[model samples]
Target: MNDSENNLKRFGENLARIKKAKKMSYRKIAANCDLEHSDIKRYVDGKINPTLLSLLDLAKGLGIHPKELLDY
Candidate 1:
């Protein structure tokens, strides 16, 4: 994988960990973030790289800092 792909994978893992820790499901979190459920799954699967704005929305939906997702 390329650098960008590796970063996305890391972010995905971190996001999944945090979500699980908070007892949140992909569907619930996606709804809270006003995103498609598949989008959340794709992100968590590291099959898609979210834009900065999408990341911000996800963090806000999770009541977390965006850096928390990126810092993984």
Candidate 2:
């Protein structure tokens, strides 16, 4: 894959890892933020790219720093 695609995949992996580690479902995480479960799933599946604000929202929902998501 290209660098961008690889990065997205890595990010998705990291997101999934953190989510799983916290035992949080997509719906549960979404409930804590402005995002819908579908959108969060898309992010975790690496099917969509998130904006900066979306990243922040996810971090907020996950109760973590935004840097955590980028920890890949």
Candidate 3:
């Protein structure tokens, strides 16, 4: 895979790890972030790269800093 694809995969893994560590569910996170459940799943599944805004929303929903999500 390309660098971008690899990055997305890593980001997805990090996102999933962090979310799980927080004891949060995908559906709950999606609802809190005002994002579609499918979209959140795509990111966590490494099927799509999330936009900056989506990342911001996710960070907010997770009660984390945006940089935390990008630390991967």
- Which candidate wins on lDDT? 2
Candidate 2 C-alpha lDDT tens digits along 1-72: 888888888899999999999999999999999999999998888889999999999999999999999989
Order candidates by TM-score, high to low: 2, 3, 1
For lDDT, candidate 2 versus 3, the one ahead is 2
TM-scores for all candidates: the values are 0.91, 0.97, 0.94
- Model 3: CA > 4 A from native: none
lDDT of 3 by residue, 41-66 (tens): 89988998888999999998888999
For each of the candidates, give the backbone clash count: 0, 0, 0
Q: What 10-residue stretch in candidate 3 is worst by lDDT?
A: 30-39
Compute the lDDT of residue 44 as modeled in candidate 2. 84
Count backbone clashes in candidate 1: 0
Q: Report the lDDT tens digits of candidate 1 across residue range 1-72.
A: 999899889888998999999999888888788788789889989999898889998997888988888878
Query: Cα deviation of 17 in candidate 1 (Å)?
Result: 0.6
